[model samples]
Target: MADVATKHPMEDEVKKTEASSLVGKLETDVEIKASADKFHHMFAGKPHHVSKASPGNIQGCDLHEGDWGTVGSIVFWNYVHDGEAKVAKERIEAVEPDKNLITFRVIEGDLMKEYKSFLLTIQVTPKPGGPGSIVHWHLEYEKISEEVAHPETLLQFCVEVSKEIDEHLLAEEEEVKTPETPSLVGKLETDVEIKASAEKFHHMFAGKPHHVSKASPGNIQGCDLHEGDWGQVGSIVFWNYVHDGEAKVAKERIEAVEPDKNLITFRVIDGDLMKEYKSFLLTIQVTPKLGGPGSIVHWHLEYEKISEEVAHPETLLQFCVEVSKEIDEHLLAEE
Candidate 1:
């Protein structure tokens, strides 16, 4: 395996220079000290139990450069075993031992055509305190065109692989969605206590945004909520509002619900919210990551759209974004 790139080496010629402005970057680092052992065990070798035989395996993702564990080796898969899928080949460019960093380049594959090239660096960097570690990822890419899919496809793969790894690590144990008992919500803010317990507060926070009464163009302005079984799955809800001063509305139907897990989802039924939008789904879930207190709230969303105008999910996504923060503040104030 090659050594990790410590310094950003300067290139003399502009042979491979980029002109496009940096679009955006998303980073999700987690300090999972308790999971260190599990990680080491699962990654000790080719995870046969995890099985790399499936299609879309991207060949050699398990191998790295220089012929070490997942290094210096290339592997391939048929994606869904549809029997007709493209092959991908990548080479491990650099590997750091102490830092647990591995960098690779997809030198051969269909992806290279549209992506030109991409640098995927994964490192398990140590956190400031104790034995904790951060799964650090750095992705630098040269887009092939304005129509190229930038981060969506890559992000989805990262998330899925993360989940799979987590699943493998916690194989023997099951996640207690809703414990037999409600975990003690340690040191909650007083306001959060009063508000969360208040009928109006729960009513406001439980469903869609009650604050926005209209959907103004380019904005999540006016909107209202309508739903059956407000917090359960199979529950249907509708939002009518104005964006940028224009009246609009989208009907939503609940597709899934895991109450014990405090998760409920809704599919957008109708709306001109985005020209590229054909459908949207929202998931509201509350997880007590800190057990008694200090819970990290994660509001997960999934969308599949067709229109270019409505493809930008930022505006519509803002509602969930704000709610997560609001919930955190409300909890802290009461703590």
Candidate 2:
């Protein structure tokens, strides 16, 4: 976050009145403990959520033109700067998803008053042999006059905001996936009524699974992905569970996610259940209840017993019921 203008070789030339229109560049690199794709996706597709991730600095963001994540889209921001309120309007100039790069050009705001033009680009890449990524922020600008100071504050702001986002990402990755455990086989179907949004509930299980452990830590000790990313079909998830006075673990792969129908299916590939069951599959479907704000959550478990001595899945059903209730209450509290 050092002021590059003072030490840079071009310092005198940049301050010369004759070179007022000369473009000045500043760049900073930060390492964060998060997926590169996830961090890039936050700015590309979910910029509006930045306030939630860094409430102290960013107050809000609104779409002014086109759609989010699209080139040429205009976004307006309300933020705090130098202990004062400020605003900025920017247009997305470029987006390279494969390379995890996004560029924005300042179109209007306080920055325009001092600079002829300003461009901000962010690139993220995975760190080799590590669990995190490195983020690079590059700023290119031309001052309108020699009186304009270098954009040192703006560069510091970006670094601080990146740190806040990195902390949020690291917190979500704390969920632990344990080793395989014993298993059993049987079929059980039950339904519970929930006065909550079906789409929200489905999204919780699909994308924000880290929150699942937070909501029902007693029944679900932790959850982590073994293969692929969360919310994608075929992604494998390992769950640590406490059931019937015993600790258990299950490894399952997502078979389907039908957001339109509010349904998700998971088929167990290996786990504690495999010890007693030949196969196990779980499906959850949420539908809005008639004439109300509630939803009917249907839990279906299909399994083949390894032997006749295997007990039924009564306790398992109760576990699901309790977890669902806990999640319901968590969602309600947030509202």
Candidate 3:
């Protein structure tokens, strides 16, 4: 729990707490009723502080300050919903690992005027013997007026989101024979085979196929330079595609490069690849095979995902695989 002191009480009490109680009038109030369930293995332990990849009220999101995953991080959001792209900024107020409670305060945004102000805090608590964890969507508010819109509708949407997460987690847990190691320590090692180069060592990596029909966003997406100097550190690029009428974009930055070794690291900086996915990083190692050895390439990608978008990684992996196959076929035919 964060030691945040409310600037003032939920609302100003006309007289006093004792006086309000005596008069049977509540000093502070909330028009929301919320509940939760047991632990869902896939999402319960993962970090929660994130911005919707498509930030606006619309179909896409981006954070304000751009620090999407770290504590005390601030991000702005833009979304188009019902034809309106409303924007908002939020800050992570409190984080409790043992208790699984992560809170973000809406410092400024569309929700400010409705209530004197609002604090949005979410908690993933144990439900004892239940199959899924209880996600507590607690919104503390100081309303500007009695006629202000209640947060009930938003709470209702959160409920649906929790259910969706539960389903996705359950399905994923069923597919994996063993649970993934939750800690970052031992989980980094993967079974991806890296065949050693014989003489002039080469690497093998997977890249996505260009979506032929859709024109990618030239600014920050799609097989092109997105930001900064094209090949320098801090430079940015966007990879994009459209699947089933939904557009997908991944934001990445050039973190490091070793020209001598033909190596580059692309860090996911921002974009609309997944809901609540702030940053994803990929490391590509390229080397010449020598003696007509053909080059080898490898890709490593990491991202933060919302419980709802937990399954996003598999899709990206598939894209990598498909692209790899095509590259191999093309190279063989050329020879």
Top candidate when judged by lDDT against the true structure: 2
User: Cα miss at 126, model 1 (Å)?
Assistant: 4.3
Query: Compared with the true structure, what per-residue lDDT tens digits does model 2 show for residues 152-187?
Result: 788789988898888876664552222322233345
User: What's the TM-score of every candidate structure?
Assistant: 0.37, 0.49, 0.40
Q: In candidate 3, what are the lDDT values of residues 288-334, reduced to their tens digit?
A: 43223344444556665554434546555555544444445444543
Once superposed on the true structure, which residue ranges of model 2 sit more than 4 Å away at CA?
1-22, 175-335
Off-target runs (Cα >4 Å) in candidate 3 are: 1-63, 66-69, 78-85, 177-335
Instruction: Give the poorly placed runs of model 1, Cα more than 4 Å off.
Output: 1-18, 22-26, 30-66, 70-72, 77-87, 126-132, 172-335
Local accuracy by lDDT, each model: 0.46, 0.80, 0.46
The number of clashing residue pairs in each candidate reads: 48, 6, 34
lDDT of 3: 0.46
Residue 315 accuracy (lDDT) in model 2: 83
